[model samples]
Every structure is written in structure tokens, then in C-alpha cells.
Target: MAEAYPLKFQENHKSHWARTLRNLGLAYHQIGDNTQALDYAKHALDIYARLAQDKPKRFEPDWAMSLNDYANLLSDKGDNTQALDYCKQALNIRERLAQDKSEDFESDWAMSLNNYANRLSDNGDSTQVLACAKQSLDIYARLAQDKPKRFEPDWAISLSNYAIRLSDNGDSTQALTCAKQALDIRERLAQNQPERFEPGWAMSLSNYANALSENGDNAQAIDFAKQALDIYARLAQDKPERFEPGWAASLNNYATYLSDNGDSTQALVYAKKALDIYARLAESNPKKRTADAERSQLNVAMLAWLITGAELVVSAEAAPDSALDYDRRPNRFYRHVLLAWAANDPAHAANALENAWQAWGAMSKAQQKNWENIFLLACGFAAARAALPPAFGTWQVQLTQFKTRRKAGLPQWMEEIARRKGFALV
Candidate 1:
């Protein structure tokens, strides 16, 4: 442009002026000039906003994204009051686009909702966050169920987020259900998707690993996290700037698993590595970095230090015969229970709840209710069955007593399990 024009006055025609201004604005933004970035983005927004179109306000997701990015820049510059207003405006536009029948881009709509919801969630607005998360999940669920191969990764993340929200609400059982869905999706996702084709697969695997650690099976979780970290590490090695955060996150997840699975020594070692990467990242202030990025880096550093200071790693003992052995009739619901447990990282008898629920849900309405009774009993027993270490000498007597009591279609048994945290039956 400079070679052609040689002077701004020579290229001051409307189109030429707009083009030069937009390009210069982008150049300014790339150099960390938030003021100019915001100005240029707004100028572009005004142009796009003013241009009339024949169609009824169709999808303008890119505009929303631009606005959102601009808001992030403003927010970073300590103008969150203005930033919040811009985000609200962008969100309203996306919501409008999502609702318009002619511009029903479900995937884009879901992405917009998820992004805005995550921002809202981080902003300490739980009410709006969950509402938007649910809306996004509903859309993603429909898409995933219809085309699992295309959208399973997204489905997994949304379900995981939803389950976490439910757990936060103290509805652990339902949370488990959602967690299982996410884990199952991720497990399926981790297989066969070529690295070149599905880059996000590694992130899905990492989330699965985290969910597993939370569920109480950190050993298994470690394996999954290792798988993810291996992939991410390679990616980071190939492209450090783009993949550093992911690699760092994977390290943090792996360290967490080690800590949970009774290997604090190794956990601390890895945690410190993550901290080093985070510290360097904080200093550099790399391109496209957000406040959330800084917070994440700080949080990882904090968690790593806090965890390393602890001398003894705590161990969890699962109930006896509580986890259904994976062999018998491992149908979908059987997988379902395992998936549910993945939400919190606890493994039950793969056979027990999965097969039971499969039978229960398959049965007629009357049969469903009957089987539900059995499920409740099994769930209660599962809690007791897991917690009794070998030192609990009365194991046989307790198991016998619990099963017998459960056979009586008793509510007390379920209430007890709910108290212990297997399925939150209460």
C-alpha cells in the first residue's frame, strides 16, 4: 500500500481510506496496542453495522466474535465496565442470530453460547453462566447424538461442564450421570482420529483424565492424562507458542492425578515444571493472551505449591464388590454407570449399576420401578462395600446385614448411601 500511495492524501478515497485504516488498526493491535485495536475493531463494527443487507438479520457470528475480542482487550486495559457492556451487546447479537430462523447455525450458535457462558461463569455470574451452559449443551447434545463423529468432542466438554455445575449444586448423582456421558464421549474420541484432522482430541483426553481423577480412580486417570500429555508435549515441542498452554495444562492434570493416586513425590516434580512454564508465559504476555489466561497460570502455580507442601498423600478405598466387575453383560447402560462415575473419578462395579440400570430402564414401566428398587439397594451397598478397609474385621457380617436389609426394599439403605456419596441417592 505504501509503495502504491506514497502518501495518505493520495489514497484518501472512501474505500482506500477504510482499507488503509483497518489494516493499520490490525497492525497496531498485533503490536499490543489495545487502544488502537479497540478503535479499529469498533470502526469495522460500525462499517459492518451500517451496511444494509437484503436478508433479515442473518447470522453474524464473526461480528459477535470481533466484539467479544475487542471487549477482552478493553477489559484487559482495566475498563471492565465498558468491557462488560460490550460483551452484553455482543451476546445479545449472537442470541438474536441464534434465534433467527433463516440463520439457524446450530453449531455456531452453541459455540457462541458456550463462549459467552464461560466468560459469564468466570465473571462470577453463576446464574447466567449455567443457564447459557445448559442452552449450549442442549444444542450440542442434539448435534452430537445425531452425528457423534463430528461433534462428540464438544458434547463431552459440555456434558462435563454441566456435571460440574450439578455437583456444585450438591446433586452428585445427576452430576455423575453427566460426567459419565462426557467420559464416554472422550474415550471414544481418543481413538483413531488422526492428529492432523482432530487436534482438539488431545484436549478432550486431558479433560477425561481430570474427570477420572475427580471420580476416584487416579491410577487409571494417570494413564489417560499421560496419553494426553504425550500428545500435547509433542505438539508443544513442534509449536511451542501455540501449544504451550495445553502442554502446561496437561502437566498440571497429570501432577494432580499423581497426588491423588498416592505419588506426591512425582506429582510435585511435574507441578514445578508446570509452574516454570506458567511463570515464563506470564512474563512474556504472548499474543492473544487474556486475563483468564493470567488467572489460569496463577491458579496452576498456587495449586502446585499448595499440593507440594502436603507431606502425605491421602488414599481412597472403594467398597468391596462395589464396582461391578467389567465382564458380565457390559451393555450401554453398564457403560453408562462407568461413565457417570467418571464425572467424579470413582469406579463402581462396572457390572453392578450398569447392568442393573440397563435391566431397569429396559423393563416395562412397572418393571422399571421394581428394578429401581434393586438399583437403590445396590447403590447403598456400594458405598459401604468400598469404604471398609481390610482392617474393618466385621466385613462379612456388615455385607450380609446390608444386603439382607437392602433386599427388603428399604429406603434406609439408600439414605445411608446418599450420606456416604456414592450416588447422592437422597
Candidate 2:
């Protein structure tokens, strides 16, 4: 098509060529070839921008849409700064277009707002997250009221985003309300059109489960999480390459819930599975999947530590000093639970701490140094469990020393934990 068309000509052929380029870009994005996606998207956007600048009435919408697609690819590639700029440009154009042609551009405006909100949330701009999310929800709500068949799905999506923002802001009750509303809408949509809406339904179910878990409804949370897992399992069976990441994420959430519920063995299984999936994904697309892969690895390591802690707490048994069954990291929840359990069963605290410390000492110097933050965190947990506040303070002092002496390579999680626990990190 590009060969057949002289792009310099003022004809509809340019529009056709641009559409083809844009579709190719979108296809590459869907298949996770983000490099090619960005290449094609930028080329399409260049043409659309030229056309829109030449004749705004005919090509402005296309230009805005191309901007949106480019922004989405950039966002997927973790370039939120560039993504936000492109998304803002798209939003400005869509807002202006909607003001003149509400019926034609209202949906586009809502979509652009959603994209902007997502980028803002990724950047942790909490103040702007709620504003963009709420505005997007309001627009979608009005549009869905007027055209349910056309806009309800978008409205449901906006509700989910708003619910996440609310959850992050610590409004668990309202977040659950919004999540449930989105779930109900998705359920209805899926019942009427399963093939078209099942994926959305599953995603909403996962979000709803997270909200329920945050609200302390563990039983109900597992029910919804399992439902989402079931759906994603089927979807991934059909298209593993496309849906496996979602499946792995759902598994991770379920594993966290199970871990909190004291199902250590099952939680370990789920965590390992999630880590395996993320490892494969990272191998295929390291640039995009490395963060998730590393986080999933951390989850697996935490689960291993939790299992060891739980067994130590329950069996009142000590492992050999040289055992390597568990990594020497401290999980906040697991450590807290062990401390609480030791409060009632004081007899095992000394043995558990001794064995855990020995296990750490058995590790190679490189491994111990590699996990210095985790080692300090574990020491703090042990000291707190032993009713030795001074010992915990000593560990914190050591952490401060490490931060002061070593200017880099310190784990950010240690600083966050210190800040959250009212301890001075620096």
C-alpha cells in the first residue's frame, strides 16, 4: 500500500496507508514485539500528524488515536515519562474534539483519560491518579447511561481503575464497593456475550478479589480469586503465550492469600509456579518482563522462608545448621505471625532464632553479603520475637552503619520498612 501511494498526494490513499501502518503496529503490540510496535506506531503517527496539520477537520481524530497507540506502547515498555506526554497530547486533542462532536469523540475522550490515569498511577502521582480516574469514570458513566451497549464496558473499566486508586488511598470500603460494581457489570456482560467479555470478567474478578482481601474477607477473597484463576487457566490453556502472565499474576495473588492464611505448602507451590512463568516471560522479553521476573523471584524466596519459619514455629524442631532449604530473608507478615505465635509458645523462640542464625552463618560470604538487608531484617524479627528491644535497636544501628559506610547497593525495602516502623533509616 505504501508503494502504491505517493504520500505527497492530497488523496484518501494516504489515509489508507496510515491505517494499514497503524494496524500493523497494533498487531505487533498485541504480540509483545514492542520495538516493532513503537517503530510502526511512530511512522503512522508521523503521517497522521502531517495530515492533521494539513487538514485538521479530516485527520485530527486519527492523529489523536495514533498518539494514543504510541503512548500505550511506550507505557508498556516502562517509559512512563514519554508515555505521559503522548497521552496528554492525545487527551487534549480528544477533549477538544469531544467538545465539538460529543457523540463521536466522547468515548475517545474517556479512553484517553483512562490512559492518562494509568500512566499517572504508574508514576505514583497519587494526587493526579484520583483526579484522572474520577474524571474518566464520570465521562464513561454518562456515556454508558446514554448508550449502554456501546460504552458499558469502558465504564466498567474506569470503575475498576477508580477502585484501585481508592484502595491505594486506604478507603477499603469504598474500593470494595467500586470493585463489586465493576464485577457485577462484567458478570452481566459476560453472561450475555461470553466470548467477547470473558477476559474482562476474569480481570475484574481478580481486582474484586484483591479488594475483598484488602477488606479482610479472606474466605470470600479466595472464592473470587479461585474463580479468576479458573477462568484464566482455561484462557491460558487456549493461548498460553498471550494469557500466561495473567494466570501467573492470579496465582501470585492467590498464593499471598494462602500464605497469610497459614497454608504454607500450597503457597510455596503457587509462588514457585508464578516465578517459573515470569522467568520464561523474562527470557522472551527481558526489557519488559525483568521487573516482574525479579519480583516473582522475591516472592518465591519469601515463600521458602515463610515455610521454614512456619515449620519451625509448629514442629518446635530445629534443622541442621548447614541446611539450605530456605533463604534467609524476612517476610514482614511471616515474621509478625511468628513473633505472635512465639508470644504464646515461648519455648520455641530461642531454638528457632538460633537455628535460623546458624543457617545464615552457614551461607557463603558472597551469599550473606548479597542478602545483607534481608539478614538484618531477619535479625530484627528475631530480636523482636525474643522480647529484646535493645537487640532490635542494635540491628537497626548496624543497618544505619551499613547505609552510612556503603553509599550504594542497599535495598530500598529496608529503608521503607524503617520509615514505616518509625525508625530513622539515614
Candidate 3:
């Protein structure tokens, strides 16, 4: 193909050459070789740009398509800023083309709007995200009504995207509805054509799981997450490069639902699996996977801490009146502790320490010992200085005495977690 591309260029078949380049880019992207995909997409876009400038009417659509392809490649590489710029260019061209020939280009225009909305999401513009997503969904819904077979899949996808934005905006009820609708369509499609639609069905299941989880339906969330994980596991076994990311994501979501359902031990196992996959992915594409790896690592650490009964005690002590309010207290306490240690937020740390100190006075000897062990496990000494309250002098002496009496370092698991979390043990 490389040898033939030069021949096509020499013969003045530049359009053909560019189209082949774009196709090659798509191929590489499908296989998850984003580096190669981006390189090919860039070349294709350059050729298309030159051709479109010379003959706008004849080549502009192709050029816009190339821009969209390039944008997708850039997005996959974690270059969101550049991706948004290119996506806007594609949307502008497609919008104008659709205005002149709606019958021929309206679908393309709607697709570009969806892509633009996705780019806006990466930029954190919630207002514009919902606006663009709504516009795309409206267009897709109309198109699907007119031609169900031709446009139903796109409509379903638009519904899923719109659902996410709705959920993010705190419209959980509507988001759940949209997610369920999308899943219904995909389910029917998969039933009719499993080979072509099963992947999409699995994706819809994952999205539905998220919506359910957001609505506090942990049991249903876990069920859907498991189904999605099962499908992704099979797909990844057959095509690891193309499907492992999705599989890892499903594992991460499944772990969260399990933890929420009071299965921290099982959650830890799945979280570790997700972290392993993301870490391996980061080795090859740090820009794209590093954040995911870090997030999964944090999830693994949180689940491990929960399994150790630290979060339970922290929740109970942090809110004695509402000790059973496991969700809010544990997360709030954990956040304050991390902020104290990582960001040196004196106010939050002081508050957390004061609460812990008060709780310590009320505990039995066995509970006191457990609390001491948990304090060490949480690396409380690392934040003790930053979190010193009015009684810090006495507390510091007490901590020092405890440390000396123990005369032992952090447990191996705690040490590894500290290393991953970038925490220094004194």
C-alpha cells in the first residue's frame, strides 16, 4: 500500500491516495494503534486540505470528513484541545453542506454535532455540552423516525450520549430513562444481529449500569455491570488490544457497584484488575491512560482500606449521630484526610484530627488498639503536622510514644498503597 500510494500521487490521483490514507487511519484506529492512526489521519487531512482549497465544491465534504477522522485520532491520543479545534472545523463545513443539501448531508451534519458535543464534554462546558447533545439527539430522532433501519442505531447512540450529559447535570431520572431507551434499542438490534450489535449492546448495558448506580439502584447496577463485563471479557479475549480498555472500564465500574453493595473484598479484587490493565495501557500510551491508571489505583486503595474496616470506623466516628450513613461520612472523611495529606489543607486536616481525637477518648481498649493500627495504616503521621489542632502538642507526643512502642513499619500492603499514592512514610 505504501508503494502504491506514491504511484497514485505521481499519476495525479491525489484524492485516491488521500482516501486510502484515511481508510488506513481508520483501520489502525479500530485496532487501537492510535499512534499509527493519528499519523495516517494527519497525512490524509493535509492532502484533503490542499484539494479542498483548490476545488471547494468538489472536495470540501471529503476534507471535512478527514478533519473529523483526524479529530477522533487526536482525541484517542488525549490531545483534547487539538481534537476540539479540528472537530469544530469539521462541524462548520458539514453544517454548511447540510444547509444546501439536507437530503444528502444532514446525517453527516448530525454526526458532526455529536462529535462536537463530545469535544465540549472534554472541555467541561456543561451548558454547551447539553445544548449540542440535545441538538444532535433531535436531528437523530427525526431521522430515525423517517428511516428506522438507516438511522435507529445513531439515534440510540445519541440517546446514550445525551443521557450521560443529563446525568452529569443532576437530571438522574431523565438520564435513566434515556439510558433505558438506548439499551432497549440495542437489545433488540443485538437480538436480531448479535455479531454486529452485541458490542453496542454491551456498551448500552454499561451506560445503563451507570445510570442505575447514580439512581441508587445498586443491585440492578451490579447486574447490568456484570452482563457488560461478561461481554467485554469475551471480546477482549478475542481482541485484547481493541477491547481490553472497555473490559477494564467494566471491571472498574463493577468494583464500584460491589463496594457500594457492601462487598469491599470482592471490590478490591476487581479494582486491582482494573488498575493492572490501566497501568499496562499507560506503559504504551501515558497521555491517554495515565489518568485512568491513577484513578483505578486510588479505587483499589480505597477498597483495600474499606476491607480493613478503617472506613467503617472512620464513618462511625466522623458522624456519631448518623453512624449508619456510610456513604457520606466515609467519603467526606476520606476526602478531608487526603486533602490534608496531599494538599496540606490545614483547616480540613485540623477538623478531621479533632474529630478523631474525640472519638479516640470514647473507645474501649480493644477498639483503641484497632484505631491506632488504622491510624498507622492511613499514614496519619504524614499529615499530623499539617493537621495540628489546638491539642496537637499532646497528640504529637502520644503518636510518637505509640510509634516507638510499635517499632514496626507499615504493613507490606499499606507500604505498596503509600508508594502508589505518592505518600511518604516518616
Listed in order, each prediction's TM-score against the native is: 0.54, 0.70, 0.68
Q: Candidate 2: lDDT over CA atoms?
A: 0.73
Q: Which regions of candidate 3 are displaced past 4 Å? A: 1-12, 24-39, 77-79, 276-294, 309-426
Candidate 2 regions with alpha-carbon error over 4 angstroms: 1-10, 281-290, 309-426
Taking the tens digit of each residue's C-alpha lDDT, what string does model 1 give over 1-426? Answer: 455655334423433444455566667766556677768777765544433122224225545655676666665454545666777777777677667742356776677676666555434465776788788899898888888777777777788777666544335456657776776666556566555433466765666664454444556679988988888888889889778888877887787677555565676677777767766775675443432244344334334434454221222213323332221112223234323332343443444344445533443322222224334444544555453223334434543543343332223323432443444432
Worst 10 residues of 3 by lDDT: 322-331
Task: Note each model's CA RMSD in angstroms.
Answer: 16.7, 11.6, 14.0
lDDT of 1 at 26: 69
Error of 2 at 207 (Å): 0.3
Better of 1 and 2 by TM-score: 2
Better of 1 and 3 by lDDT: 3
Candidates in order have lDDT scores of 0.55, 0.73, 0.73
- Write model 2 residue lDDT over 307-334, tens digit each, in one string: 5643222222233223222222222223
TM-score of 2: 0.70
Candidate number with the higher TM-score (2 or 3): 2
Q: Could you tell me how far off, in angstroms, the CA of residue 37 lies in candidate 2 after the best superposition? A: 2.6
